[model samples]
Target: MRDRLRATLALVVVGLLAAACSTGGGDKGFTGTRLETPYQAADIALTDTSGLPFSLVEDTDKPLTLVFFGYTHCPDFCPLVLNNIAAGINMLDDDESAKVDVVLVTTDPTRDDEKAMRAYLDGYNKSFIGLTGDLDTVIEVGEPLHVYVNDGKKLPSGGYDLGGHSTFTLGLDDSAEAVALWNQETSAKEFAADIRTLLTDD
Candidate 1:
């Protein structure tokens, strides 16, 4: 399963590179990879940590939205990405911060209930929104974004390993169209700089 996930990720990376080239180097000023073709935000209706229906498009009031697909149980990737984003937001001015909304959609909903999701996200940023729902619903939400989500190999203890999921953090504009993506390796400084660029452009 790990091998298959790696292959899929490799293909995704190749595709992103090809798209970047074909698009004549999209939005060169941004630190993240600009999309060749923007993606309209998925019309998602998921339960937030507060047990309220959260509509990705309608609920977000910010001009810029950062959407990430991950689970709370992830040992390294999830925390790293969330923390960096949180730190990046902290670097912005109050007005700039208010223009951005960070959202996390759990890939493993079986264990990531509303309570658990809220607790996990609070450790990073209290303002960060976490969404969880039925596994099928979660998969459907990720499909249009090209963020793959799948269960991992089982362990001898009857538990499973970390789930397979895409690591890109998508950047969405006011129109709810995805404009860019950041990989797991992007630093907090890079995130802040790119966000500032977006805000200025807007």
Candidate 2:
């Protein structure tokens, strides 16, 4: 088990390197430059769960995005994190709000089509975007984000577990570079506050 986990981590790291080098991204238009990304990424293209082309190069022109990785079938963490996003977005000031986006990217592409993703996110806020693509493209996004979703299978009782996942959420600059990352546990209020600071700064 330990060896398997290590191998998985290694694979993620390698994938991240690939992502960092292959993207053709440019700068986001944020006058406030106080926040800097803790990690940098090579601009990459990823389709949202809605099957729309969402490229880092194109979309970063807007406000910062709070990106989270999870699947539709995830019974708990997925929804919980999204709810936090909704709450946080609601808390932003008008000007600050204009500079923030909340997006959900799915790890399970096979089961999470655009319709499925849309339905899942509808429970939270219709404005929240759900992104998914082919398994290969999905990996391209997850690797750079460093998210891992475990295998899912039928349990003895018949209700299959959607596999455990390492929770990953990040705040990104217009350049899609990671400015702040919140792992398994981080407060929504704090995340909201930090985003406001980033949005309002010059």
Candidate 3:
């Protein structure tokens, strides 16, 4: 099931990218893929790293929000994406950085309780917000964004592998609508560039 969802997502991304390219996306001046129809940010309440109720649209004060869905145990993509975003934000001026918010909603809530989520996110950027709650709630929140989340294959060590999930970082505007999508392969430089463009447009 997870594999099928991932394949479907890949195809969708390819189609979006192709459409953007054919339309001369250069006019947008964004390094990330601009969504033809933006997704309204989910307003559901979830527990933040601080163990307090948080609403993505209400709690975030920034004009631009970058949200990602991944688990702490993800062996590769999660850390890499977080690190790149952190680095990208660091490239901006103090005022510019302050205008953006980074959010990570864990896909593996079974192990990513409030405390664990906070600790893992601090390793990349202390300012980044980490959120975790019931797995069902997580899936519900991700639905509008086309983010796939599911338990992974069990392992022999009495543990399990990282869960399957989407790797795109969604860029949401102050209106709580996702305006762009950054893939895992996007470099820190590209992130910085797109962030600047988004901020300027906002």
Candidate 4:
């Protein structure tokens, strides 16, 4: 069953990327063998939209996170992904909902400073935190998560395009650990269900 789920998930990743692969924490409770599954999440570092230091290490005590990377300037996909996440969170039971977090790690640090992030996130989910830091530091953060961004140039037409990048969504457990070999790449509806399961374990 787990193997079949993994296969389904692999295909989902491929499809999202072709469509342009697109697209938390805090302690509550639960001691069930964490990560009793097949996959686990990666650790990373970034700053929240408020410029708050968002070190993954610090969150080891918090519930796991659903991590996604992209820039705010992202034309369409970024917003859709974020809105989808917001929709998922809305489905959670109020109590279980407090155990998880959604993270937006920005690729366009040049423009996505604390003030910018805070403003951008206000439009959608207030629970969401956007993060950015120094270019080198941001690059380092993306490495472990396998997120990439290609050189972008200002177009004569005004806006620019993402030169190179891969969209990915990652989930982590409440112990600040990545859920082992779990299914990702789910829709807002599907994601909400997975989140509910994780919250129950918490």
Number of the predicted model whose TM-score against the real structure is largest = 1
- Per-candidate TM vs. native? 0.85, 0.70, 0.84, 0.68
What global local distance difference test value does model 1 have? 0.79
lDDT of the candidates, in the order given: 0.79, 0.62, 0.78, 0.58
Q: Which stretch of 10 consecutive residues in model 3 shows the poorest summed lDDT?
A: 156-165
RMSD of each: 3.2, 7.7, 3.7, 9.0
lDDT of 1 by residue, 1-202 (tens): 7677765676566456536633464556566877768877677799999999987777876789999988888787789999999999999999999999999998777788899999999999998999988867877777677765544434343323333336778888888877778878789999999999878873
Question: Which runs of model 2 end up more than 4 angstroms from their true locations?
Answer: 1-37, 148-165
- lDDT tens digits by residue: candidate 4, 17-64: 333321112223321112333233345567776556776556435465
Tell me the tens digit of each residue's lDDT in model 3 across 115-171: 998899999889999988887787788777667564334434322333333677999
Candidate 2 lDDT tens digits, 102-154: 78776777777788888888888777777776655655665555443433333
User: What's the ranking of the predictions by lDDT, best on top?
Assistant: 1, 3, 2, 4
Pairwise lDDT winner, candidates 1 and 2? 1
Report the error of model 3 at residue 3, Å: 5.0
Clash number for each model: 0, 6, 0, 18
Model 4, CA-based lDDT: 0.58
